[model samples]
Target: LPAEKMAYLRSLQQKNKRVGMAGDGVNDAPALSQADVSFAMSTGTDVAIETADVTLLHGDISKISYCLSAAKITMNVIRQNLFWAFFYNIIAIPLAAGVFYPIWHISLNPMIAGIAMSLSSVTVVTNSLRLRMLIK
Candidate 1:
């Protein structure tokens, strides 16, 4: 039974799956090392803290759920930031290159486009800062 847990973790990783393991760190060191994400309790052995990607400061297992939620939110923010960046490039680049002048009789000033592009980056940063509100 002692080895069953690590075997299961290893099997999941070998299958190219995302594996998360929570442990005291000493006995589970090998499994923790193999996991895609590992959580160690603050009260756990020193080896666990060193090996873990995250340490549960409260040493409560339930905190793992909070961490998971934060991770998901962080990933979603990243996706949104990337989408905004790509979208900005797609439209701004064409206008800046004067591609719209022949079709719409509108000539975009490069200076204005540059300002708009910079605002896109600022908006993304402001959006990402929303993550701080989640901490509590």
Candidate 2:
């Protein structure tokens, strides 16, 4: 298709929809530039590859789904890690400070608190490592 038509199609699609363009021609550069997510074949024209958001190394369309899936998984892991870190600190900080000493006599020893803090960091790192298995 002509570059003009491609650009027009991109404009129409962008009004209320996300546009994803995949093309290997120099003519596709304009549309690719305007797309929300543009994918280009590594074997395609230089212009197309340079304009695209992602370049498929083997020029395989299936990799796009895999890329998107991995991105979602990575984002989930980040959120989980953030939640774990914050939750651990929230519960551990007060206990370490002896906030419950007046009524329930609950407190964390300094040495144990240090170990627990280290363990919480390990938990976050371990959770992030789970992504390798999931993506594979």
Candidate 3:
């Protein structure tokens, strides 16, 4: 297929949709460069490989699904960790600073606060580790 035709097709698709191009030839480089996500085979021309967003090291096209799935899972794990971290800080900081002492006479002991902070960090790490199980 002509490179110009490929470029024309990409232009039409890109106006309202994301385009993913997979190519292995130098002639495919331009379209690959323009694609939202481009995949190049490891055995392809150097220009195609360099122009693409991702290289399939073993030239197995099926791995693209795995890559996309893993990316989504990783993003979710990051959001979960951030939420836990922020939630811990929001509740923990004010108590440690004695903000509730006047209202309810509640104060966090410094040693206990330290332990709680450490535990919060551990929780985030453990939550991240859960991804290993999910991804496989």
Candidate 4:
């Protein structure tokens, strides 16, 4: 039931999928554990920390934004990587299969493929690094 409740709450949020739980007592432990990510007070019960993925060193609730920001950055990087991987395969597979031979007879060069692979890495890293400049 707790997990279902958490899932319902997650579905209610827009765009972001992060959930932060604040608890100082045992009753909140189950809900805290059900979140995708969680934070607990340093002075909170041990069960709280055991259930949370992160424990706030100073018990400051404000640090929740930092966690959300990190999650957003990670999601963005994942999207970028997925896009590059999909794009590479979509083009490379057709080329490798000789889909263009009927017209230009052009094929993808191994050198170009290597460049594209390297650029994919660069693009994902650069996009991830941009999170550092984002205001929390």
lDDT of each: 0.87, 0.88, 0.89, 0.75
Using lDDT as the measure, name the better of candidate 1 and candidate 2.
2
Tell how far residue 86 is off in model 2, in angstroms. 1.6
Q: Of the candidates shown, which would achieve the greatest TM-score relative to the real structure?
A: 1
> What lDDT score is found at residue 132 in candidate 2?
84
lDDT of 1 by residue, 23-67 (tens): 885788777887899999999999988988999996899999899
Better of 2 and 4 by lDDT: 2
- Summed backbone clashes in each candidate are 0, 0, 0, 0
Show where candidate 1 strays beyond 4 Å: 1-4, 14-17
* Model 4's TM-score against the true structure: 0.68
Best by lDDT: 3
Error of 3 at 5 (Å): 6.6
Q: lDDT tens string, model 4, 1-136?
A: 5666566656754446656567655666777876666778888889887888888877888887877777777787778778887987888767866788788988877788678768877887787777777635
**Runs in model 3 lying further than 4 Å from the true structure:** 1-16
Q: Is candidate 2 or candidate 3 better by TM-score?
A: 3
Assess every candidate by TM-score.
0.85, 0.74, 0.79, 0.68
Quote the lDDT for 96 in model 4. Answer: 65
For residues 14-68, write the lDDT of model 3, one tens digit per residue.
6877788898998889888877788999989999999999999889999989878
- If ranked by lDDT, best first, what sequence of candidates would result? 3, 2, 1, 4
1 against 2, candidate with superior TM-score: 1
